[model samples]
Target: MSIIIRKSLLELIFSGAFMKRWNDKLRPMELVEVDKQAHKMIVAWLLFLLNSRDLDVVRKRALGESLIEGGLFDYLYRLVITDIKPPVFYKIKENPDDYSTLTNWVIKQLRPRIMPLGDDFMNRMTAYLMQPEDKGLARRILHAAHLYASYSEFKLLKSINRMDHELIEIEESFIERLNSMRDLVGVSELLDEDSNVLGGFARMCGRLRFQKRWSQTPRVPETSVLGHMFIVATYSWFFSMEVGACRARCQNNFFSGLFHDLPELLTRDIISPVKGSSQEIGELIHEYEIRELNRVVLAPLKEGGYEDIAKRLEYLLGLEVGSEFKASVNMDGTIVEATEEQMAGEYNIDTIDPKDGPLLKVSDSLAAYIEAHTALKNGISSGQLHHALYRISNRYNETPVIAGVQVSALLADFD
Candidate 1:
């Protein structure tokens, strides 16, 4: 909870892990060309948005019949699909029985992870998607966008050696289909002229695939900034659940974790050691990141009438908190009410409160530890990674709890 620990958590989140997808093995791509964890998170977020749309219609139609809700189906679907070994996926694609087996395998793997809801939701999802009916306008549109994003990522990786023309055509076709369905889905009513915002955001998220992590480490798989964001977000979500976070707090933490490093998209991944070299240097870097973020990211969104979204991002990224370092969200997702003296004296000192920033910091460290452990497991050797693992482990060893969650137990799961 000290400033040093807080800064270290931020550093680790920005530090990329080398994660290799099965597909990368077939191509000339490096062993770790993609951030597997991050990609899954992005897919999850997309699905969350899709499922979040049209709650009113879904509630009315429920009419007492139970229906799966809250984007869980979409999230689970992407999580399983992304983790599928490439060769297995290819085999499934080639045979009907294999695909069926794959689906069952996915259900089995996910069943234990998702408790309480159990197989009922998973079974419903399998049955629903197998032969989906017209669920609603929003559901359909979001579903198309999810498919488009997933396919786009898969096709691009698959066609690394192929000509761009085919890829371009495929993308164009997908976009055309999405645009055609826009009016039918009443997107204008939902978002007005800002209907294109989601698409634009998707494109930006895609850029993370190109921004490689750990530029200095050789012979290791590279993680993208975007992917790191996803991992942090996912970790934060699960950690929030462990702490019994309210719905609004969980959502805020997830999103905050998702965009924690959005500034890196503009400034690139500045390693933590460099930022921590000196207090003055770190302050200067922070200043520059905020300026560029406002000019390049937030200002434009505001100009485009996405003020609400821009404000949310600002809060998530701690832009609004400034130097006070207070909690970002309350139990209801509203900004935590704290005077400057109260924030500095109590909140800053007791950094383990069940607020957004501290919880996110803990999740960030957990993610960093996982990334380092994963890379080490994959036979990559780096002193920096080893040091990171040691440092994180040692730091958390003395601290066993955060916001009522057993932090040590959560980290132990990685071991």
Candidate 2:
């Protein structure tokens, strides 16, 4: 069965941008749901790496997929049920019947977007949320990631919170949550928050919140690299499913979109124009990013006994293929570009570790187009943004349906 690319689904994911976090208290910087989800996933990945080194590769990938799906389930649920406070939501959750009714409504709204992934995925989302209990490693990792992300927000608002009467109770709740997750692997160090190893990873990702996209241009609800990454990752998963990508390919595509711009964290978000000014400059920038990624991020993790995570990162970033936009498969110890037929055929299996790079690239471009389209629609006009929207729209118009996504139609919705 083929999946249709629906504007509603894409819009639903982008809706996160408008969702303000900690709305009750003032914050130094804008806190948005999309960026928080991205930060949480990053922390979750680090925790996954630390805890799963001894696990088999199959289980490791399954765990990763579980976290991604489960995290999205929670995110989508929160998106619609936005008005309720956390305490109130938990109270409702305690009543299984109430939780089920509300969660079922959420599932119903999301079904058109999610059922394409298959019945199993739908079942998992319902079960994960409905259980409302510790569901083992994947759930623990999700909870810890959620807590760490919230705590990061808390730290930022600490000074502001100091003046608020409810700050103490909120702070104590965070402390209690952290204490509860101390038993989680690699989470104990996060308790220190300032000097610990896991905290360092979280901080680096958190800093991305400060690095807003299109800095030269203004937009309502300015998005961060972290938020943009989350949108792309979400889009990639949706696109991957539409293309009937295998489980490995789908997960690979999603994570690749998530981390594709991670090197930008090291080099800053160098605009495409500047990067493409000259072949020499583009290659030079690429070489620099690769060097820095290995030196600062990867080597340290590998040395710290996280070689598997480092290796996977290298693969996802297309260090071997020279670009993450190229479809690829690991074949006989070498990463090789694979054709559509090959991907749909023998390479679909998880053992080969296929990645739908081309699909990810489409998702990446869609995210960018939405960003520009969103700004323009919000009345923040600029030559650069218009040019971006025009370029992307025309590109898809020229060759619509990239990797099974109906690109032209999706763009039409913005018109």
Candidate 3:
């Protein structure tokens, strides 16, 4: 993709949405006060990590049967009751047997623009929702995510005014749960090494809530950097599915979208316009970002035997890796296979036939368009946003297809 496209993508991710939550009037909650997309993304990432555990094959097989029988959908049904008095909350509470209905409702709310995996996702979600034994890792992780979301929401509330007693109580309760369950998910190991790693990471991510987008424009609710990453990752996951991305490719695109701007955690969100001021300046910023990432993030992970995670982050952020290639193991499991020159030229990436790189680019553009459209609908006036909507519309119109997916038709849904 060209530099201009890249810049526009970043700008869109940074733009915030202006919708209100159903339960905003009930309490001093930050759900509708902060970036909704970012919170959803955080929840999704937590879900991803929870699902990636390497369970023993024998145990997994044994638990798999039990999971299917034990109402896995019911577990997910309860996890989404973040509000205490919402009608949905009472509806589920009143009718305990509405698991399938509630599960489908949640899925509809959470479903992306395009579901590449389709119905298979519910089965996969069943596996992720399984809790084999007492210290069920999946259940614990969901609880942890719930607590973290509450903690982060309360923190956002603190920024606008004095923290409410109810919010403080909620935050403290989450902390207590986190403290109790820290040992369940290898957070204990991280805590022993760096006593505050978990909390620090959560706090850092929450800081993105305050980092507003379109600083010069009038936005009803500004999008944060963290929220933008979540939206991009969500979009990428759907797009990846639409293009028939392999398992590995789907995971990569989802995670890459999740942490694409992680360097911003340390460097702050360097706006796209500044980054694209000139090629030389952009290169300089990239160098500085890498240097700081190594010093602040990667170096510690390496010292703590988290090299695998560090490398994954590097690949996702395109730190040391170039964007023009994708590599995968062949079915034979010995030699690697790569797309030839003509295929690579046609698809924009040399390694993966599905071309996740360009696929993510399209998702990024779509996310930007959504951000602009949402803001405009909410009465945020900005010449830049208007121009962006027009530019992206024209750009995607001229380029109708990407990685075997009909880009124009996919985007037409937004109209």
Q: What is the TM-score of each candidate against the true structure?
A: 0.69, 0.93, 0.70
Q: Which digits, one per residue and each the tens of the lDDT, describe model 2 over residues 1-415? A: 5566677788789889989998888889889999999988888877887788789988988888888888888898888887687878889888879988988887788888766567776787877777777668988898989988988888899986677988888889988988888887788776665665456656777888888888898987688999999999999987877777777888888888888899888988888889989999999999999999989888876776667778988999998989888878888899998876677677888888998877787888888888888888889879999999888899899998776678888889888
Ranking by TM-score: 2, 3, 1
lDDT of model 3 at residue 396?
76
What value of lDDT does candidate 2 attain over all alpha carbons? 0.83
lDDT of 1 by residue, 230-298 (tens): 667756665555554544556667777777877887788887778889999999989999999898778
Error of 1 at 369 (Å): 1.1
- Candidate 3 clash pair list: 16-223, 38-227
Name the candidate that leads on lDDT.
Answer: 2
**Any runs in candidate 2 off by more than 4 Å, and if so which?**
108-123, 192-194
Reference-based lDDT, residue 373, model 3: 71
Provide the lDDT at 63 for model 2.
88
Would you list the clashing residue pairs of candidate 1?
32-221
Q: Lowest-scoring 10 consecutive residues by lDDT in candidate 2?
A: 192-201
Taken over the whole model, the C-alpha lDDT of each candidate is 0.55, 0.83, 0.53
lDDT of 2 at 415: 87
